[model samples]
Target: MKINRCGQAEALTKEMFQKVLGEIKNDSHRLIFALCWYTTERPSAILQLQVSDVYGSARVPLEKMVIAARTRKDKKTREVPIATALRQELKAYSAPSEGYLFPGRAGHLTFSAYDKGLRRVFEKLGLRGFSTYSTRRGSLTTLSRSGAGIRQIQALSGHASLGNLQRYIEVSDSEVAAIAAML
Candidate 1:
């Protein structure tokens, strides 16, 4: 269905995201989807993450920390403080050291694979106009509407410049209503 990562795709609603999340049965795939929704980082970055990056040899608290610079697109490290629920999910997965979190036949799950997997989920749901960027975009839009400053959103997004982050947020009509209601 030609789901482009550019601005062509609109941010998905939480319910819609959940529906897609629910459809993914594989534990690795579920974690990938959850991480996309939770971290708001690039899907490729999440896919490139090693087992040690997520969990060390021993258990640890889910602190706000940079998820290894190796996987980052900008090559600039960014920190995401994950939720307790997601932490538990990661812990439950029990990954081995020195390997990609979501491994496929060709080593790690490629961007195309992640994109295609998500595409299949969306197609099954009869959804249109969403892509790899949807979860990240949707999270940013939600944060903006919830009264988070642009910089705060940028913190999670790791947007290199101020102008770059603005592109991810699509202001909604309800946001206008929210402004009017606040008066």
Candidate 2:
């Protein structure tokens, strides 16, 4: 894994992501990370999600989950389609009727609290440099590798600009070699 500046978190490969997810024994915490991975949202926005934003009257997962504008770094609300993995996690979790999904005394789950739990998981797995942002960056990189258009990823991630979004994508050496061969 490449070490980046303070603001940048190392992106995990899909296998590494699964390993991290499996290490998380807490159901709520597992769901939290799954939401982060699948929705490609920041941990703060994911933590602030209202139960209604994810579930309907019968506690069914919505097709699209809303990341509230207020919690977003760019303050732009985006509806992310729930991936199958995230939907399964949501189903396993018993969500409350209303209010924050991960509620804390201060209103919603504090970033520090979430980070603490994440840090423990990482330490146990001997992973260094991975943060809550890892999932978001990983998801974007995965999308880019899968041939999704940069504009599509930008929309999904709600990035203010393509340049900012591009920074999150990690180009593999093999991918570069393949492009060189094509040339």
Candidate 3:
């Protein structure tokens, strides 16, 4: 399988995200896109999120979301902490406790549907070879380049090994040029 490089994935412009969000007619779709982009979660994990997994009171600002995920890759359950931006987005599109985070027409989200949505978004943007996994890769790349350590990223992303984490960190040509400029 061809994995998306971190550099190319991070290169996903804000305009692209906005365009995709705008194209989504349903409130649920927009919310799902926001969650995926903000949390850097795999579609499978994202699909499994429940309203109860989010821990914040209505009295307080919904800025923090606690996501409990059971990843097939890791075969372990992990909790991911998301920031206010994503939390606020989710709150804006809040669903009932029994509802799926990204409910489909059938009333529950599926991995295949999530994958198709991501592919459609990329296709609309004229970006080929991009997949939902790119979101996770982009998140890891952004954090790593921002000075986060492998251990930190591993913890946040639930990767089993540093080697797997390293695969997500793509050194870009711009980065190379920037470094050369300093020399």
Candidate 4:
């Protein structure tokens, strides 16, 4: 794992992810975190999403939500397939017409605000070492453990390179032992 000044964010289990979701009372906030997990998109990019980006003209959720190049860290446009859970959230969410999905003073919801909200949820749930980026990291790790290839994950995450993407994947000792036993 790549160590950074702030330390790696803790990747959550499916149960922990669900706990976090249940803790968030606001529908928009819940959807935001769900998108973070399901889309593996950064909080900033998800916050900046326009209504049309995730919906069709008929107001149905798009099979793949468009992450414009301008909003992506890699400056490459990506189309992330919406997971069934996230599709349900989108169906229930009241996305604004022709504007930012999470509207704020400057246009979209600020990263700071999102972070603060998540921090509160984490604290209430007694979760530690989790951050706004945790869902993205957790989702990536979950996909890796579920037998997704590096290239396939890279396509979804829009990482600049495989090495960068690898840094996000976490391997537990139990998984290592299981692999050894199989071998």
Give the candidate number with the greatest TM-score: 2
**For residues 1-183, could you state the per-residue lDDT of candidate 2 as single tens digits?**
436426578888888899999999877688889998888888888888899899987999999998889888888889999888889889999887789888789887788888889889988998888888899899999999888999999888889899988988998899999999998
> How do these models rank on TM-score, best leading?
2, 4, 1, 3
Indicate the worst ten consecutive residues by lDDT in candidate 2.
Answer: 1-10
Candidate 4 lDDT over 63-112, as tens digits, reads 99999988888788888899899899999988777788888898898888
Tell me the whole-model lDDT of each prediction, alpha carbons only: 0.77, 0.87, 0.65, 0.87
Candidates 2 and 3 compared: the better one by TM-score is 2
lDDT of 3 by residue, 1-183 (tens): 344533334434445566766776667656767666676666676776666565344523244455553434566666666676676766577576554556667756777776676677677777765666666676667787888888988887777888977887767899999999998
Question: What would the TM-scores of all predictions be?
Answer: 0.85, 0.92, 0.75, 0.91
Off by over 4 Å in 1: 1-7, 59-62, 177-183
Residue 175 C-alpha lDDT in model 1: 71
Q: Give the least accurate 10-residue stretch of model 1, judged by summed lDDT.
A: 1-10
- Among residues 3 or more apart in sequence or in different chains, the pairs in candidate 3 whose N, CA or C atoms overlap within 3 Å are 63-84
User: How many residue-pair clashes does candidate 1 contain?
Assistant: 0
RMSD of each: 2.7, 1.8, 4.1, 2.3
Clashing pairs in 2: none
Model 1 residue 177 lDDT? 91
- Misplaced by over 4 Å in model 2 are 1-7
Q: Tell me which of candidates 2 and 4 scores higher on TM-score.
A: 2
